[model samples]
Target: MDLNYYDTLIAVADDCPVNGAVVPALRGGKKTVAVVQFDMISADPGGLTQEDVLFETWLRRRESDGLSESERAELRAQFFSRSQACLRASPLPKKYGWGLRFDAAGRVTLCPMGSDEYEEIIAGEVPGVNVLKAMRSKRA
Candidate 1:
């Protein structure tokens, strides 16, 4: 399934406690999904699609060091063969105070909560940009 969000901005969760986007830190000497996602997106803004981010994060965390190209392709197919949660459930927006913006081409970039871009997105000042909030942490 294609999981790209075009011309959309996913704002931070309402219950996010941080005032701005914070880099996700290593946990227990290992990179969590949030850290991986943050590192990938922050490294190259608008360079990756949501599917690329999710699959690469999952692949990196696995033991596929010597897999052949076909094997890797198979793995990717298996990974995406089932339903996957989108970025709205991601910790970057729900916990790390970052907004996710998808351009018309479906490439994604991180927008920190207090950044000018984030402000513009949430305020509906950016044309053709649909805004949605990340899933809340608490049940209300």
Candidate 2:
């Protein structure tokens, strides 16, 4: 398992493996939880591609917003406290994975990484927003 990729996944998901939830709010506030599962089409074992790294980084950056001081503290604590546990709980599969998004309602949405979609995203296509336009632009 790629420790770096696992770390990146945890950083993006923001969920603790031990508690199965976002680290509790230190000062008491709201926190979002995201679950990213990678889906590889091929059965062959290999490491993540450069595109995966870029996409994951972009996803993490997009999620970092409006966090209060206490919330930030909780995140830090959880990251440190459950780092090992998280690694054990969610090991990245050698093949394809799906990214799950959990909102305040705890609903999980599967985010598919279609090749064209991924390319568009890399080219600055905002998923669910400008996907069509992005796709069209790729042809232009």
Worst 10 residues of 2 by lDDT: 130-139
* Candidate 2 deviant stretches above 4 angstroms: 1-80, 84-94, 99-108, 115-117, 127-140
What TM-score do all the candidates reach, one by one?
A: 0.94, 0.21
For each candidate in the order shown, give its overall lDDT on alpha carbons: 0.91, 0.31
Question: Compared with the true structure, what per-residue lDDT tens digits does model 2 show for residues 44-67?
Answer: 113443233333333454677777
Model 1, span 40-115: residue lDDT tens: 9989899999889888888988845888999889988999999998899899999999999999999999988999
Clashing residue pairs in candidate 1 are none
| Superposed Cα deviation of residue 102, candidate 2 (Å) | 8.1
Clash count per candidate: 0, 8
The runs of at least 3 residues in candidate 1 whose Cα sits more than 4 Å from the true structure, single-residue gaps closed, are: none
RMSD to truth, every model:
1.1, 17.3
